[model samples]
Target: MALFFANGATFATWGIHIPTIRERFGLSDAALSLAMFAVAGGAILVMGRLGRQVARLGSARVSMLSGVLFALATGIILLMPSFAALLGLLVLFGIANAGFDVAMNAQAATVEAAHAHPIMSMLHGMFSLGGMAGAALGGWVLSLGVPPEMHVTAVALLTAATALLTRPLLLPDAIPIDNASTTDGQHRRMLLVLGTLAFLGLLGEGAMYDWSTIYMRDIAGAAAASASAGYAVFSGGMALARFGGDAMRKRLGAPRLLTWSAWLAFVGMLLAVALPRPWSALLGFGLMGVGAANMVPVFLVTAARLPGVAPAEAIANVARFAYVGMLLGPVIIGAVSHASNLRAGLGVIAISMGVIALCGARSIRPAPAEY
Candidate 1:
């Protein structure tokens, strides 16, 4: 959990600084989106191979090492002198961040399986908590006139220390060769459906993560320090909702939960675009946080348990799709915003959420009653 928290914090720190980074680079929205694509491109490239690495090396070892690498990469990104240099470094950042993310989630899934129960949502809740902390802290420091270099350095040190201390506490990977076998046709179809849902859910999430602060700054007319407040509030809402997600899932079931969440997200996005006031935008983002909190976790948990599919393979496939959405999200928004406006681009997100609401229920099949 500490590792998850650290990873989330590290990622959030980077996210909160994006507006500053954009200003430093003097990047237009399209140019910034292109740079952002490098981050996702790197993650997608590495995610395809991550399952094999986790299988060979074990999740515990990979998580620790990747945590270190993730911290190092975050620390170095702000030091890039030019736009081209930032783009290249962001790719490295993406690779390291993706490695850490996969290894940690793989560990979480292993832990959940050992207990024979649902705890994925709680584990993910810890991540949202970390994001909340990171965004709030980054905003506070930036408001105090701290440099991005100093902010990232402090985060790097903290995450590195957290990883070292928590490595010993993580569960070991125990996915067996039998359970890791290739999938059959029906299984493949199910995996694809689940992956598609995850892709859509995470597409919205990625947009919020990468662009919320910018949106707050540009569209909501927020001051520089307070730009991240909306993001912080968003993370807080996600954390609170995810902490309760397990109970909600038990009551609501995954399919129904996902369906409603998408509707919730659609309403939230509509509010943001319709009002465009700082307070209203923050409220909308918070509602978005609530709506999006459990979608990926539910998808990942469902994938991991799909009959005939290896847990690692299922996770990797779904994660790949999710990351693809995440990568394309900012670029898509950037392109739209460049051609039209930010509100129009965000309307695209609202439509995507509506599609998810309409289609999300089809992904989950009735589970067999078994031990």
Candidate 2:
């Protein structure tokens, strides 16, 4: 949980510094989208191989090393001398962060398997809480005239220190699963479904991460001082919801829980598109945070439990597909906004959420044994 929290904080701190970087580089929306693509690309390229390594190397060691590397990469991003240098650093950041993501989740899955109840959601909740803290604190420091490099450096140090301190607590290397009969046609189909669902869930999440602040500032006419309010609201709602997600899942089950969540995000995005004011935008994003907070965790948990494939590989495949959404989300929104308007672009997101709700209902159906 501490590892997940530290990783989330590291990423969130970088997120809060984006506007400053954008201003420094004088980047257009398209240019920024391209850079975001580079980040996603790097992650996608490395994740499959990373999964195999986690299995061999033990998730704890890999997670710790990757977490430290992730922080270092994030800190260096602020010091990049040119757009190209920034892009390169972002790619490096993506690779290292992806390593941390897979390793941490692998660790969580191992812990979950050993226990009788759910814990992934709670661990993920810690991630959301870390995001909220990082964003709030980063914004506060920026307001106090701290440079982005200095702020990121502080976050990096904290992340590295926390991971190092917590290193001994993570799961140890385990024997490989012996259930060779687990993989079958049904399992393959489920893998495809889960991967698709992961894509949809993460698409919305990445969009919110990359675009919510910009939307508040540019579309909702928020003042410079208040632009980050939307992001804070979104992250806060997500944190609150994730803290409750495990209990909710135990009560409602995965299919129904995810179904409602997708609709919630849909409604939230609709509200934002319709109102387009500062407070309304914040409210809408908060609703979105609630809706999106647990979708990825649920998807990941499902992948971990799937029969046939190794847990790490299953997760990697799902992550590969899912992260495509994150990779393309910014570029798609940017292209749409460039041709039309952000409002229209976000309307597409609203509609996408509806599709996700329907698909989640079908894809997350109970296993045959449960039925």
Candidate 3:
């Protein structure tokens, strides 16, 4: 839940400030895209190693430390005097984000295992909820004429408080070593397939997060500040859906739920691309959120249950692949938009979700009987 709040706050920070950064740096659209890509690059370059570090140091310790870094990096980005310095700060934020992502998910998986219930989806939902609050707060702050430094500082303080509050709820290093041994031989192949599906799913998610507002403002003719509401609505719907997803998953099972989610996302993306009105486009984005809400959590659970790998190792491996998707999604969207229109570019994202819906079942095996 704390992680989710942090997720919300982080994106809210970025979404509300992106325009400010663009103005401050006198950045062209392409240049802004490249700077955003730099953040992804940092995450891609460091996530695998950071995952290993988390495994060695323990999720609780890593999460606490990463939270501090996350807060500090946000502060630096707000205070940096030059574009180059800001870019460097983003890199640090990216690294901290990567570590936070892996450690939190790893911790969640442990908690879920102990409870013998579906909790991962709800945890992610909390993140979406946090994101909504953060985005709203950011928009409010900007509207109230709060300076970037003060706004970001407020976010940093909130992040630190959440981290400390939730620190006690996270499990210690108590996961069974035997669980790691299950991913041997054929298990490795299964894990690879699950990881690939997760990668594709995450790519779609990243595109939505990084590009939805750009699409709205550029294609739908929304005002700069109003455009962010597209993501806010999408994220709000996702949070609500995720809060209910665990119960839904209990009724439908992971395989069926994922299949439906893919279809929903595909249809939602198509509508978003086809819709001409801003309101309709925002609704489409919301539908996409509903579709995507459960897929990642379901895949992460599958990864954790793979044979011959510890839950931590499995999460690390799969998370590395997911980061690739997250990194590529926005960059591809930006590149495509530079070459064509943003709408035409986002159409590819819809197609990718369609393909995932078509193939996701084949990519994941049923959870092991033991699980």
Task: Give the winner by TM-score.
Answer: 3
User: Tens-digit lDDT track for model 2 on 24-119?
Assistant: 999998897677778788999897687677766777888889888988897688788899989988889999989889888878887877777778
Q: List candidate 2 segments past 4 Å from native.
A: 19-34, 78-86, 142-150, 173-183, 213-228, 274-280, 338-340, 367-371
Cα RMSD (Å) per model? 3.6, 3.3, 3.1
| Residue lDDT tens for model 3, 1-371 | 77767966785687678888898889998888777877777787786567557767778877888887887787667677888888888888888887787788888877877876688899988877776687778888789888887898888887877777778777875455545444567777776777788778888888898899988898888898899888878877788889888887778777777888889888888888898568888888988889888888988888776655666667777877887888788878878888988887888878877877888865664674333
The lDDT values for all models are: 0.83, 0.81, 0.79
Candidates 1 and 3 compared: the better one by lDDT is: 1
Off by over 4 Å in 3: 174-185, 210-232, 273-283, 333-344, 369-371
How do the residues 187-243 of candidate 1 rate in per-residue lDDT, one tens digit apiece? 888878887888788878878876899999999998999998877777778888898
TM-score for candidate 2: 0.86
How big is the positional error of residue 120 in model 1, measured in Å on the Cα after superposition? 1.6
Q: Where is the poorest 10-residue window by lDDT in model 3?
A: 173-182
lDDT of 1: 0.83
Clashes of 1: 0
Compute each candidate's TM-score over C-alphas.
0.83, 0.86, 0.86
Residue 45 lDDT, candidate 1, scale 0-100 = 86
